[model samples]
Target: MYDEKRACPRVVFHAEARLAGADQFFDGSMEDLSRRGIFVATAQELAVNDVVRITVLNTPILDLEAKVVRCTDRGIGLQFDGALYN
Candidate 1:
């Protein structure tokens, strides 16, 4: 299956991810990655379209802003402007 809202194809990836809001924080991992977005495996519930800063632990891309696109039982889909931290 392909993501219709994605600009690039998604790839299966495994990376540490942290989502931080103004008053909340979630610790999770990035389950997959695309050019413009990623699927963050977070257990905590986040509202759709909510903006969050993503920090890939120990990576260069710190505090990347992303909009929540989809929130499922497993995780949340994030749309960002740039690449996912490698």
Candidate 2:
């Protein structure tokens, strides 16, 4: 089994999310979130290390900037540039 090595723990969260890359933009669903990063379930393909703008479509409309760290057949993992939310 693989060891889970993370500074922060992810929380189970679902929300409407939008991601904008350099020239591509698409809508996805936010699966989970933590202080340092978030997991977005998007069919849209994004390369690792790609910088993207993330907008959480909620009543307050949370906006954040993140980089693609991991990618899978189901979704993508993103790491925030800085501490946007606490």
Candidate 3:
């Protein structure tokens, strides 16, 4: 059997992510992150196509803006606008 790998790279860290245009924010733990996108889990309900800004703890210098591509009961999948990570 061939094992399928993720199309995007993922980073493991605790971060704070907020939805743009929404007054709500969530404390999330990044499951996997890449320059292209990131996966995070939070208690809030995020709809698909929702634009958001993410700031990783201790790494606030890099402001990441992304759009929600998918959302599950536990987490959300985001796609970066451009080169979000260097």
Candidate 4:
């Protein structure tokens, strides 16, 4: 059984997303969102501990800074530098 170790609950949220890293850019979509992090579905390659700027397209939200925490064949998991608040 897998353990749910997340500090915050995640909600199903689909949104077009852009990831910007040093000399790297990826177009992806967010599958789930939480106050502390998000999971982005993308084929683009990224490494753990990489810093990236995230922008949710067509939204009023400002750009967010995050760090890559987990990577899988399906997507990458990111932890925001700060909690996402309204």
Best by TM-score: 4
Question: Candidate 3 versus the native: TM-score?
Answer: 0.73
* Model 2 TM-score, 2 decimals: 0.87
lDDT of 4 by residue, 9-62 (tens): 898999998889999888998978999999999998899999999989999986
- RMSD of candidate 1 to the truth, in angstroms, is 3.5
TM-score to native of every candidate shown: 0.80, 0.87, 0.73, 0.88
Q: What 10-residue stretch in candidate 2 is worst by lDDT? A: 2-11
| Candidate 2 residue lDDT tens string, 1-86 | 96658788777989998789999989999977888888999899999999999888874977799999999998999999986466
Candidate 4 off by > 4 Å? 1-5
Q: Where does the lowest 10-residue lDDT sum fall in candidate 3?
A: 13-22
Model 2: lDDT equals 0.88
Model 1 agreement with the true structure over 1-86: per-residue lDDT tens digits: 95477557788888897889779988988977887898998788988889999888868876788999999999999999566554
Which candidate model has the greater lDDT, 3 or 4? 4
lDDT by residue for model 3 over 1-86, one digit each (tens)? Answer: 95647665556655665444367666677767676888888766788988888776666476678888989888888898986646
Q: Sort every candidate by lDDT, greatest first.
A: 4, 2, 1, 3
Q: Name the lDDT value of residue 29 in candidate 2.
A: 90
Off by over 4 Å in 1: 1-7, 82-86
What is residue 82's positional error in candidate 2, in angstroms? 1.3
- Runs off by more than 4 Å, candidate 2: 1-5
